[model samples]
Target: MNIQDLRYFHELVNLKSYTKTAEKFGVSQPTITAAVKRLENKLGTTFLIRDQSHKSIIITRVGMQFDEHVQSILNELRIAEEEIKQNESATIPFGLPPIIGRNYFPTLVPTLLDKGILHRLNVIENGSYDLYHLLLDGHINFSMLGLTKVNPEPGIRLKIIKHYPMNIIVSKKHPLAHKKAISFKEIANENFIGLSSDYIHTRALDRMLKQSKISINTIYRSPDVMVVKSLVAQNLGISYLTTLSITKHDDVVSIPLLDANQPEFILAAATRENHIMTAKEEELWDILTK
Candidate 1:
């Protein structure tokens, strides 16, 4: 049966009068009767008891049990409609790692705004670790960040959007600047600038170096990606960052760190495990993938 059929049956159950139920919708009593009949035929079960001689109407014992379930479905439908409207009108809050947000949001957000899918956007800049938890906890709608080798929590889901090559960023004056490529072993003595220790990228780099018994000097650290880049540009140290994090700067150059199969920086979108893409989220995904 259709929504109209369910609506008729719902109202009829509460009113216990087909005529009054039809009156509520400004429809004929026979229309209500036929709607309920259609619903019963579709479900193969009677939902009401009618007294032909006295014109009395009563809900069936089975109807009472099914009414609870029908009411739940109706309530959920109503809630979904309201949420859709709110999603269109309200500012939707989502998250992104600092570098990804900086590199991608300018184009992505405007594209969505131009399409009229999003009214306003709220972005949270965070490390991948925190961003994943935010999604699992339902703190943000969705986020773009890196996922290391470690699997995330049970209720968090990720989809890889793109891969960026991890680059060694250094000042033009630095001796390594002219090199075609560098390896972790060769940079053992170089000072390093990095994302904060809590960031997954930083930790991953730490693990990589530790495995080789090599430790570079970590001279500077910050949660802001710009700071890390700026430090490298000033020759304070070299830093490992994805190509997406690079901006046009005269003082610095990004050179690839060579490895087999071309290791890459992965960027992904995270959402609640089973989040169904509503209009806004679906539009965001489209722009991201394109």
Candidate 2:
């Protein structure tokens, strides 16, 4: 079957109107009708049936099933086109989440500069959740993803760089700050500050709470880690964060959770499984994986 026929048929299924599909594709109504007929003939099944007035159509069960495949096919083609374009471009589209970019990514910059690939980077900074989707959709070439756990996805390759324990952070003056470690039960009813849902910390926090059967009052949420740290430093509320974000310069104390099985914050480098890296991209990937 012709590729154009697949496009026409896909849109026809979505719009459910021959005139609208034809208008959208800038083709005649007969062309749309012929495309559908060609696909049905090739498949050896009746995909659709038009009413006597030819003004409406009823998609057969086979048609719906085929439409699902068509959607996947079209999406793959779109990603293929984007990947080809990315290969042709001189600059690499790199994704970095804010937390990783701020705390972890700087460690790689010196090596990147030494390798002379730093100038070729076109960075897209966002939360890990958004960066993961962007990399999967072919909007970015590679991403340094921060996640609560290793989530396996088809057509994506992930290399675990490091794992840091998620820790509880509180102001120096807080009652629990002097403790070496604490359990979720000790602070279950305390006021809490938390990162926004976009961050992986939120997922780890939620899972910890659920597993421990504990709940706390979250007084504030911020996408900025600094804001969360500031709130915690002022003794307004306690927060959870990864160890990578903690430093001697910060006023807050990082205390480990005493849970038997605490979730870890994972740092990973992600790229499309099918992507053929250019020489420069390969060098960058090597440095990252190292």
Candidate 3:
């Protein structure tokens, strides 16, 4: 019936347990029960059914229909809060890829902080897929991601910051290191240190390799780009990686791919489509793109 009651309902549906919801909200179980009961009474409909055997609550069809509206209301509340904060002071909560955060942003962070227009800045290092979801969910105001192509979401705007080429990385002592370019077929039989299957980069590589009738003999899998680079440096395996990932490494050698002509990945910055940018964020975007 009220915002707090709706929030309680939403949390209960999400957690699927009144006790867990009570714990999360720091409220008594009876208080949570009372809230839900009052909401149900006001709505004149049964929104949830308890599965006694599993001790879990299940949303009914009517609940499912109402949930969409509830989510929209929550989103609006979040936007309202964000706008109020924006009016008081300018801040940009940005997200960046782990590789970028480690290698590039340290120098820029101090300068941005010194600018003084930046009231607050939050930087998170995460994978590109996770970054995409964070941007879509309004958890981050902006994100820098490595993607092959731009697929615009309904309320998102994207700017391609750079195009990094793909390269085959191997130990300096490896035979392919001397080559100007190596073909997929040449590395097909080589032991490969690769990104994990969940990563977007891995999916793109898999699609390309599948088309070439080549499969990497993956000997190691990791989410960390640095880990894959280190394994290649140890002569354990060869890996297909971006130039950005390999250019600074001294232990490994990178050779351009002979057959793969497309850009390895496009590093992009994205923000909400219609959102107003703070001056600091706008300046940061300019610096990144330039």
Candidate 4:
């Protein structure tokens, strides 16, 4: 009935000898016998049968069935104990988009180490759609993603950390890089490297391009923002990317799209609405947002 009784029962089945089980558990043989007897009494079923010649123990038919359940219970208890240990050790499972994880997380990693907070960071380079799915399924604790108009489900929350404008990125040697600002219409015929269709930025870019009657000859589609930038630098194609994506790259020049109607990317922190963030995560969030 109790965890101790279950543990005794599980060990008794494994060792197949009450004397051996007691020795392993640092208890007397009589104590093991009494505990197993008590468990059998509570369940109204005998768990073991004694061999007449050697006085060894053999599991009864009923005990075989109960053993499976007891093993499951013991396994669950072990998992619970492990989870508590991990929590006590200050290990947190965090999820983030790869771009953000690689670019910005390095700044906070040492800070977390200094505080003795260990992070099991889950990096996913997939677009926002996959990240949202992972968060909703409780596979990830939190994510930073491009802002979209979709509403979060109940118990999920979102905070706008910063507004990022989408910029047209080109290699310094590219002709369009000379223009301080270029209209979408001007670049309509240009070859483009773009985010995959699932990305919000990609959708936004497609919408703006459509409205301007601009047709992009998309040469590459990727989820990695760095890849997009690198390809552009090679003069393979030009692409539109958020300022965050190009912040560290000097070889690429990001020119603002001149149209007043051009859409801006909003970088937001997303978490379960009612779920609490650890003190360290909250601190990191504050520092990053500031």
Candidate 5:
């Protein structure tokens, strides 16, 4: 019925032995047994059945179902604790992916600095895929996520702010460098340097390949955009990247994809569903979205 009883029961189910559960919780075996009995009596169900030897326990059907609820309850409690502590700190937990941080975030920096909220931001830099998970887990208050498409997810809200085209990047000396635009079919045989699967760029690339009915020979994969660009610049292999990561100073050419239905790198502002924005958070969000 209580949190401790649930914790003990959950651990007992996992460990499959009362003595082991007691050892894990640093409690006497009787205490663990008592907790389990209390839960069964409150719920009016036999969660587990112990054999005569008592070496192992068999979890009843109800026990398995109760464990699922216990996990959800525990997880929610933990997230609530984290959210409370974070709110007390008065620092906004912001998520910023690397590509957007480099190309787009600067435009809003002046506004944030003028409003005196720049120092209050706790920026967590990661790939957009990872950032989305962080937002879902309540680890971050908000994020600018790079996505291939806006899909519905539970406990999360997404709004598309901008869209950037994905392009084929090549070294200046590469054969396709002179071409302004190229289709996926034209480079089907080319050696590709792709971003890691954790990136939306990789997802876009996979979709393109599937649509074009062609497979590419990927020579290497990197999570860092800089490393991918460096390899492409060396003519090691061509790469598919979003224009957001490309700059005028980079020694590479961004050739637009000529595919009729090319996928775009989507920039979306995401936050937890029904999240109430604090005053400072609202100010910062307005600046970011503006």
Candidate 6:
């Protein structure tokens, strides 16, 4: 009957447990029960049927119809609120990839705030592929993604910040540290550390190595960039990463690889096709692209 009741109804139907819905929303089970009972009483119909013997809850046809209507109402309300917020303030739903390279822009959040470019920045940090989809679906206003010249996703307009050249990194104490560069074959017999396949860079490398028939013996794999870098710094194993990820480490040295497909990734700021930028969004974009 009320917005709270509709919200409770939505959650209860999806969660399928009155107790869970109550706990999630910080209300008592009795409150939830009473709310649903009131809604049923107000509508003069039962929305859910509870099997007393089996302790199961089931939605009736009427309940399903009501749910559909409620879903539309809630979705429209949410979209309207989002639009209003975007108009009032630059509510940019931005995406950041998990890679640590080329001084990625999430580090510039404070600067964005300082420049009055973002009234509020909703930043989502995830893998590049996921970020790309988030942009495509309009869940985010813009994203910085790992891109390549081949097979780029459709409906994304991007400005390439820089090319992330995939290179080899080793501890300064390692035997190959003094070498200028080495081919992928030279490290074939060495213990290697690799990023997990969840990463776009790792996927690119895997595909490139597979095509080149190059096999790497990875002793360890990690998803954390800092962890991989730390492992290499400790001389645990050698790893590959973009030059942008390199930091001034006392014990680590990054070198180029002679592989034909360095799988060098491009870091770019992406927006949906034909998207009109808000003044604040334009300012932020300029900061990133410039």
TM-score of each: 0.65, 0.96, 0.73, 0.62, 0.92, 0.66
Q: TM-score ranking from best to worst?
A: 2, 5, 3, 6, 1, 4
Indicate which candidate wins on lDDT.
Answer: 2
Clash pairs, model 3 backbone: none
lDDT of 5 by residue, 1-290 (tens): 69988899888889898888999989999999898899899989999999868577899999999999998888777777777877899888999998998888988889899998899989999989899988888888889889887785988887788899999999999999999788889888899999888888888888899999999999899988999999999999999999989999899999998788888998888888856788888897777676
Candidate 6 lDDT tens digits, 163-235: 8787889998899999998887777777888887767768876766776677888899887878888989999
Off by over 4 Å in 4: 1-91, 118-125, 148-151, 276-290
Candidate 5 Cα RMSD (Å): 1.9
lDDT (Cα) of model 2: 0.91
RMSD values for the candidates in order, in angstroms, are 12.2, 1.4, 4.6, 10.3, 1.9, 6.5
Tens digits of lDDT, candidate 1, 180-213: 8887678899988888865767866866687667
Score residue 58 of candidate 4 by CA lDDT.
86
After best superposition, candidate 4 residue 95: deviation in angstroms? 2.0
User: Residue 230 error for model 3, in Å?
Assistant: 3.2
Worst lDDT 10-window in candidate 1: 78-87
Which residue segments of model 3 deviate by more than 4 Å? 8-63, 79-91, 102-120, 196-199, 260-263
Supply the global lDDT for candidate 3.
0.78
Error of 6 at 205 (Å): 1.7
Clashes of each: 0, 0, 0, 1, 0, 0
State the C-alpha lDDT per candidate: 0.76, 0.91, 0.78, 0.75, 0.88, 0.79
lDDT string, candidate 4, 1-290, tens digits: 67888888888888898878898989898888888899889989898988979979889989989989988777656644644554565654455666566655676677666655544443555567778776665555567777545467876778877777888999888888889898888887889888887678878887887789768898879877778888888888788877876766457889998887777777777776644566766775565465
Q: State the lDDT of candidate 2 residue by residue for 84-160, as single tens digits.
A: 88777788999998888989889999999999999999999998899999988888889999887787689889999
**lDDT (tens digit, per residue) of candidate 3 on 1-290:** 58988888888888889999999999998888888788789989888998989988889988878778888889868875775575465556678887666665665666666765334666777888888887877777787788877777798888887778777788998988889876777887899888876466686778668867987788779988888888888899888777777656459998887775454677787888757776677787776565
Model 6 alpha-carbon drift over 4 Å, by segment: 1-90, 100-102, 106-111
The top-ranked prediction according to TM-score is 2
What TM-score does candidate 5 reach? 0.92
- How many angstroms is residue 201 displaced in model 2 relative to the true structure, after the best TM-score fit? 0.9
